[model samples]
Target: MSKLDEKVGKYIDAVKDTCGLEPDVDLLRKVTAACGPVIYQRDAETVASSDPDEMDRVKKNFLMKKLGLSESDKLDEGIEAAIETYGRSERTKYRAVFYYLLTKHFGKDAVYGS
Candidate 1:
């Protein structure tokens, strides 16, 4: 398999193992693809949920800008739920998986398109 495919596989496993959610493989692949070369970088590959700036970026960039969500408490709640679902003890929270959870959380799979 290609490198990206391998990463997607790892992401699929992470979602299944971490959150116990049956991941949508196609959407996860798309989300991983959307993550681009960042997935290859060690530091940038995972999200640092403890960082205020990182959380802000997730809210503004991913949720608000990419998903076109309004700035509201619901956005924070969705993010928190995804983080909680992913496990607060888990250190390496893959960006694609996290985004996928958020997308699923908000019923914004349509944002990814069919």
Candidate 2:
């Protein structure tokens, strides 16, 4: 498997185990497509920001805008909420897990404290 596919595959399994999420291939494709633009902005912010703190705003804006969520203090909350919309979940705030998947897909330099 390609690196991205391998990572997302693990995420699919993780979500299923964590919260009974069962995403189909079509939805996964759409999400992977959306990740392109979001990751681009993330990389840009990483490169542009002298202050590591400022990049959080860029990350939040890209993630929320791509996922069609309202602005929030927490991008991960927005992402988790968006995920819940796709499938109901009893558990909340799986952001850490989600970020782990993203980091695996995109690599540590891009998604994890870049």
Candidate 3:
């Protein structure tokens, strides 16, 4: 399996263990599928940009918009936390989904590795 698959699998297992319930694989798949195109687009954008600052901006924008939090006052804070935890890479899609699931199951503190 690919590294991404391994990481995601481990994350799923951890979530299941923490929650004392099996994760909904269908839900995880759906989230991953929905986020894939956005991740690909961000990859393309990253390749097209030589400026690190511009790349960061593009990544943050993509995360906020794709996650449907564009109008949120805490958008920047959320994006910052995500970027810090996940980095600006295609794998971020999986990380975002993992964070979403973690927050849903265990709350925000769990998401930040608390």
Write model 1 residue lDDT over 15-102, tens digit each, in one string.
Answer: 9998898989999998889889999999999999988899999999999998999999999899899999999999999999999999
* Model 1 misplaced regions, further than 4 Å: none
Model 3: number of clashes?
A: 0
lDDT of 3 by residue, 1-114 (tens): 864465457546644554345656555544444444443444531222335574455445543444433454354455445444333443323443544542343233322333
Q: Tell me how many clashing residue pairs each candidate has.
A: 0, 0, 0
Best by lDDT: 1
Winner on TM-score between 1 and 3 is: 1
Q: Quick one: best TM-score, which candidate?
A: 1
Better of 1 and 2 by TM-score: 1
Question: Model 2, 23-113: lDDT tens per residue?
Answer: 4444444445445544334343122223345335535554444334345555544434444543444333233234333333333333222
TM for candidate 2 is 0.39
lDDT, residue 68, candidate 2: 40
lDDT of each: 0.93, 0.43, 0.44
